[model samples]
Target chain A: MTRLTRAEAKARTRERLLDAAARVFAQKGLAGASVDEIAEAAGYSIGAVYSNFGGKEQLFVELLQERANDRVNRAAEIIAEAEPAEANGALGRLLVEVADKDADFAPLQAEFWLYAVRNPELMETYAERMREPRRLLTDLVARSVPDAERAGELSSIVIALFQGLVRMRRVDPDSVPDELFGRALRWLFTGAEADEEQP
Target chain B: MTRLTRAEAKARTRERLLDAAARVFAQKGLAGASVDEIAEAAGYSIGAVYSNFGGKEQLFVELLQERANDRVNRAAEIIAEAEPAEANGALGRLLVEVADKDADFAPLQAEFWLYAVRNPELMETYAERMREPRRLLTDLVARSVPDAERAGELSSIVIALFQGLVRMRRVDPDSVPDELFGRALRWLFTGAEADEEQP
Candidate 1:
């Protein structure tokens, strides 16, 4: 087995704790979860959790930040790699796939979001964390839909649509067909003219 | 006070219980709330709650159903009253206004939604309840956007967009400006060419 250096060991411990936190938070919710439970689940001491994350709320925030960064990076890569015409479709598929795979995480996300919104101090940080994904969407709209006069507003609509669809799909998956995402994206990108060509 | 009919008294009690449930659930979430607490909050006995709604879960579902019905009725009124050219904008304004006025209820709705999503049986009931609003939007889109080939799909997108903007606004009110709703509604109703005339 390869021996880990001090920094690598610390990094591994942090990752494990985050993984454990996600499970604990998802199962019990933010208010119901505790640092001790998270540490125990991660196989670390309570003191280790405090030293690494300061506290439960901090740990939750960090976990969300990491996940958001991962999503934005992956989406950026997908959009960059695809042909312009196919970029939106590829991105939509990626989103639907992620929503399906991360179904369990949605509740945890809604919990933390409510937690942050209820607490004014945390709301700022949560909003800041959300900016990365919004920015990426905005940039994509500007680049791909040059005729879209209000790219920023369109981006907001797109983000809101995706978020809403995810929630709606959780309750009734049949309501939000996977193809719906592509159709919405195409309409937003091209405009009303696309509807005329529909068979 | 005049003597009350039994049916009138029963209706009054049910309304009061629902109001209390909204407050209790909003403050303590669905799992954290109790039948006794809700009953007491409304100045009624636990028996009243059981008789009116059966239990906590049933009360929660009924509360949601009542609220959803009220919203759809109000939206229908708004659409029916507006000029054809202004119907979409009027509906969008009503949505944004309600989102602001009922900001406190958002978290409670989200909590129950999460609760229902996590439980299979509850998911069916919740999805069924959601259909009223979805149907209203579908009908609105079909009437307003004659050229929209996929009226059902457009309605889904519109509902999802409104749901999403409400959530995003809770975390960061400035991010989802009130005017954005109107803009997005116009685009969805009219199509991409609307962007070209932007100043």
Candidate 2:
């Protein structure tokens, strides 16, 4: 293994801890999951998790922040390339890219939602931790469709549809086709598939 | 109300128990939820819950069965209408109609999923619950696209997208417009919006 500088070592350890936390959370869920199990998964001691993040819930919030950030950062690139009325496919592609990039992401979304439902504490922290997706998509939709308000409506539904589809597919692969996420949105954004329908 | 016969009372009481259980499960979730709470919610004594369902887990399974049977009963009406090409849109409309008919339904769907995550034992049951939605969509996609197997990639994605949209909209009303659900599918199933795209 390559030797790391002090900063690199810190980053690596943080990443390892986060990785461990995801598996622990997935396996045990929020209420049943513990810091010790998370530490064990990361190949570190419990202290490492505490040292990096104050507690189990804090660690979970950190995990949520990282994931939410990753999505926004990735989406920004897709949006940057988009132009007025020219982003018909760009918006759809960005979402498809997300669905295709990580098979495990949808489960985390569902798991976090389950967390939010069970614990009222997480619900209030949502805008603080996870409002970017809605905000960004709203802006993207406004840009892509005319009549910004009406267009935004379509965009929001498409987004909701996209998210719902991901959760369903992750939970049961046999039931939902993998690429249906983008195809559905493509139909919404471009209105390209409408004519393909049989009369 | 007319006085019920013995069997009628038994059936009525069971229905009340299930309704109460649904509310408790939706509010507190399956793991954190209790049998006593369910019984109380149903306006019955704790002894009644045990007498009727045995325990919390068994109550949960029965809840799943009841929800499944309810949907199956709804699908029976749709099965008689053999316009498979139009069936996908029909399913989307059904979801909307559900929300319009009873605002409580989607929240309950979210709760059912929360239970699925808290107890892995519920995963199989949840998957079974999802089968009808998939079967409905797949059969429709097959009739419309004719290359459904080859288009498996896109099909999976649309399912996820549909679930995501439904859940997101159900969770937040302002962010998701009411019309997009039906309109998007109409566009997807027919070419209602074909003129909007640039040639």
Candidate 3:
């Protein structure tokens, strides 16, 4: 192991503990795993987990919600940089970037969604956070279409397509091609132009 | 109450039980709720839940998986009747129909999806069953596009789009729009046409 200064060692140890807890919680599930086991996995003492997160459930929530927020925030920041007119392509890229972007967090998220339903308070928190992504898309849709409420059926389809792509990529990565998102982007943005040229 | 034959009464009771269970499950969650409460909400005895479904977990699975299969199968049959070339359009119709078709079951399915991850065996069952619809699309894809492997990317996008739509509709029904599904269908089936219209 590389030698570490005191603060660096503490931070690294905390990160390790979080990683171990995440893995155990994800693989064995929240109810199935124990704090002691998490400590062992992290090569830390049980006191480490307690010191870092206080307890398992809170740790689980922090690992999931905070991390998801970080990701969405990063993706949204990328979207913020996009031209208003390029909203469709931008949104698609953001979503695709999110979907195929990283695998480490995806399964944990998949596990969290499971937790969200099984736990109602988490569900409320989830529902609250869910609105943020939708709100972002709604704004993007407004920019691209200029008359979203009037855009009628199109807006919902827009959200659904992004959601569908995400779900599919999760279940089977190979099935969702790299260009897949680009095609949807072009169509949602370009309308008849993208629609006709697809596949 | 109208008097009914044994079969009719049994059917009505089963339906009532399912509806009540969905509400309770939605309110209390998959893990938190018990069968007695569901039975009480249905105005039936505990025996009713036990006799019809045996337990809350099994009942939850039945509602989420078996019932969903039946609906999708029926939807598949309808899609099968459409012209071979128009199958994608048929699928779009199928998805739109699902969005509008029944409100109760959709939310339940979404809840079930979130809940399944907690139980890997259930998740596997779900993941497997979820693939059935994808298989339908895969076969349809193989037929419509001679180079199915090449179309893998497109296929996944379409599949994801459909799954995502179902999810969104449950969250906010009005936002999804009526023609959204059809539009996606038209675009997905007429891929090249969709693209050409874009650029």
Candidate 4:
């Protein structure tokens, strides 16, 4: 067995706890999930949860930060790798693919959002975490759409459209086809003329 | 006061129970709320709730149906009253206005959506209720956007954008301004050129 430094062991434990916390939060919701349950799921004691995260609320906040970072990184990579003309389509397709694969995560995200909204004290932190991803999308819009007026506003619409599709798909998956994301993105960037050209 | 007929009394009781259920469920969430609390909040007995809604789940489904109907009716009225050129902007403004006024209700809607998504059996009925509003938007898009290829798809995008904006506003109200909806709607229907024309 390889020996591990204390820092490495602590990092491993934190990762396990976050993974378990995601599953528990998704299954039982943020308000319903308890520290003890999360700790047990992570194969740790209650003290460990408190030591690492202080409480369930902080744990959730950290988890959200981690997820947001992952999303921003993935989206940045997609934009960087794709040709300038194809970046928006590639990003839209990636979002759709992630939405399909991470279907369970949507509810979890919604749950935490509600939790933060209901508790005003957490809203600032939640909003702060969201800024990075929103900025990234704004940059992408500016880069991809020529003469894109109010690129920030356009980016907000794009974000909302994606979030709304995820919610709609949850209730009626058949209604929100995989192609819808790419199609909608094209329309938003290029407009009705582009859509009319399609068969 | 005039004595009420049995049917009238039952109808009144059902309405009160539903109103109370919305309040309690919004405050406590679906899983955390109970039939007894709802009945107590409405000054009704547990039997009254059971007789009216069968259970908490049924009460929630009915609440969602009522809300969906109310949205569709409001949207229809806005479209009916506005000049053809102004209908989309009016509708978008109404959505933004509602999101501001009914901010608390957003969390409640999200909670029930999460509840429905987590339970498969409830999803079909939930989707069925959603179809009316979706169809209304589709019709509006087809009528308003000349040469609108795939109006159904465009309508879906609009719905998603509205839904997403509501979610975003809950966490970061400042980031998603009221005018953004109308601007985004115009761009979606007309394309980037329309946005660039705006001062």
lDDT of 4 by residue, B63-109 (tens): 87676456555766677678878876787677767677875467777
Which candidate do you rate higher for lDDT, 1 or 2? Answer: 1
The complex in candidate 1 yields a DockQ of 0.44
DockQ of each: 0.44, 0.34, 0.26, 0.50
- Model 3 over residues B1-199: C-alpha lDDT tens digits? 7789999988899999988987887555565577889999999989999888878878888777665455655665677578987675677667767666664455555556555644546766676776676666566656666666535555566666776776565445555655566676564555544454445
What C-alpha lDDT does candidate 1 achieve relative to the native structure?
Answer: 0.76
Clashing pairs in 1: A191-B192, A192-B192
Consecutive 10-residue window with the lowest summed lDDT within model 1 chain A: A190-199
Strongest candidate by TM-score: 4
Q: Native contact fraction of candidate 3? A: 0.37
Model 1, residue A120: distance off in Å is 1.0
Q: For residues A1-199, what per-residue lDDT tens digits would candidate 3 score against the true structure?
A: 8778988978888788778877786555565678899999999878988887869888888776666456665665677678866655677666667666554454455456556655656776765565566666566556545555534445456656765666555555555665667666554445533443453
TM-score of chain B of 2: 0.70
- The local distance difference test score of each candidate is 0.76, 0.62, 0.65, 0.76
Candidate 4: docking tier: medium
lDDT of 4 by residue, A114-151 (tens): 77777788778778877777877777777644445467
Q: Indicate which candidate wins on DockQ.
A: 4
Q: Which residue ranges in model 3 land beyond 4 Å of their true spot?
A: A1-74, A82-156, A171-174, A177-179, A186-191, A194-199, B1-28, B41-44, B47-54, B62-65, B83-97, B141-143, B150-155, B170-174, B189-199
The order of the candidates by lDDT, greatest first, is 4, 1, 3, 2
Q: Under the 3 Å rule for N, CA and C atoms, how many clashes does model 2 have?
A: 27
Better of 2 and 4 by lDDT: 4
